[model samples]
Target chain A: MNPPTPRPQPIGRLAEATGLKVPTIRYYEQIGLLPSPPRSQGNRRLYPDSAIARLRFIRHARELGFEIESIRQLLDMADHPDQSCADADSIARRHLADIQSKIARLTALGEEVSQMIAGCRQSSVRQCRVIQVLADHGQCLGEHLAGSVKINEK
Target chain B: MNPPTPRPQPIGRLAEATGLKVPTIRYYEQIGLLPSPPRSQGNRRLYPDSAIARLRFIRHARELGFEIESIRQLLDMADHPDQSCADADSIARRHLADIQSKIARLTALGEEVSQMIAGCRQSSVRQCRVIQVLADHGQCLGEHLAGSVKINEK
Candidate 1:
């Protein structure tokens, strides 16, 4: 006799199995990242076993800082196992480049802030190098740190 | 006769002088970073020359990646020139530490992504290390990248 079909797990079980918040799992569905799961008789969301792997993949990618759009492309590529992985390679490489660029900028920022703090004498605010350097951008090491470079708000 | 009073400049001139967008200037005022400027006879905003210096200071602090709250503290310190600069020093040090931590996290992420791409042979997605590593978290270098460590989403 054929084996009985595996039971579909509820959304909470999927969230537990994948280490993703329930809202995040729902959000992934809303964004079309995850397929809409079938519902039970009571109208509760039920996810197939395969949902665990897919959600885990999405969570891993997000942990590594991939944007939602990029994650969408990655998931699409993942769905087709026989397809060439050149697109995935490109996305990963581009993301790596972005990570490296952020590291470099943060390095520069760290150095500049370090220098300002080091130059401080703990004296009055008027003589504080930190305040002085901030007041006069011309005194900065370079203008590269001037505009769009923002530290992660989190 | 007393010297003539200096004419207040319009919002556009303040924007031009600070290299900050008009909305950003208005945002600073909305957030109390900049004092509200007097309106002209035609109801256009007219800022005193002092606004330029104040705005420049805010811009520089922001360019250095200081938080709005931190900038508020620094501005408060700057306003009181006779105060000790210990607070400014502490803020800079803390910011520097935060930048360093981000640099370290990004470095690790870059390495992991680089290794994944290097292991890929341009083959099918089924054999792709990028996909394999993402699909199976157990195959990753470590669990540290599995949570909160996000590459700058920008």
Candidate 2:
């Protein structure tokens, strides 16, 4: 009978499986997001199949815009597979709301930017609509949008 | 008998007009983006109508997503009132291009995020499409989206 092929074990295999760099995996370990794996005879980190699955989970959550802290919470909740998914749903819902708010803000900014560009279509710097608008704070409808509302009186 | 209404100089007037707070205005000045104004009696900063115009221009440019460095370049070009409008047009056009690029990138991100959400519709974490997708980096199509690319790798 042919001998069974030996499987590659440890950090290299885990890195390849998860599409995460080795350093990043180490960093996640350092940050306490990922549990420490077992070591081989030479002290090289050895991760089982479960580690690959967890790393992939973390990567995907990140892609969907979940912050590191939020992912940590989600990971904790996910550990108890039999638990109600109400917490996961809530997290996802909150993320959706946040995305919606960002879209709204960026949309408003886009409109304002378009208008400013339009103003400069035909003028000289002396009469440049772009310059004129920037110089006159009153001309901005989105004064509050510039930053905070703390008005500084000199 | 005639009554006199006193006029405060440019710095004071700019602070009142822009709501930018004096220190912020000074910060802008220190950056060499804004030119030092002439001083009046008692060595107080004296600003002209042009200064107000400049301040407004800076504020508007900032709103439109022009960085301070770009704004400085534009201001320099604008200083020569008789210069051709071509330079100003180029600056505005470049800014517009930058905005368009950002919007395109964000739109791609939005699509990816939405899909991730759709995949997880009511599924348990063990069977969650969101988790599955995140765990598998190969499933993503946003390879060119720089910010998203760095999220899990680092």
Cα displacement (Å) at residue B22, model 2: 6.2
Give the per-residue lDDT digits (tens) of candidate 2, residues B65-102: 67788889788877876666666666766776766555
* Tens digit of per-residue lDDT, candidate 2, span A5-46: 545458877888777789989989999899998888888887
Q: TM-scores, in order shown? A: 0.92, 0.67
Query: Runs in model 1 with CA error above 4 Å?
Result: A1-4, A146-154, B1-5, B147-154
The C-alpha local distance difference test score for the whole of candidate 1 amounts to 0.87
Per-prediction TM-score of chain B?
0.90, 0.75
Residue range A18-119, candidate 1, lDDT tens digits: 888888889889989999989889998988888999998988887777889998998888899899999999999999999988888778878889989999
**Best model number under lDDT:** 1
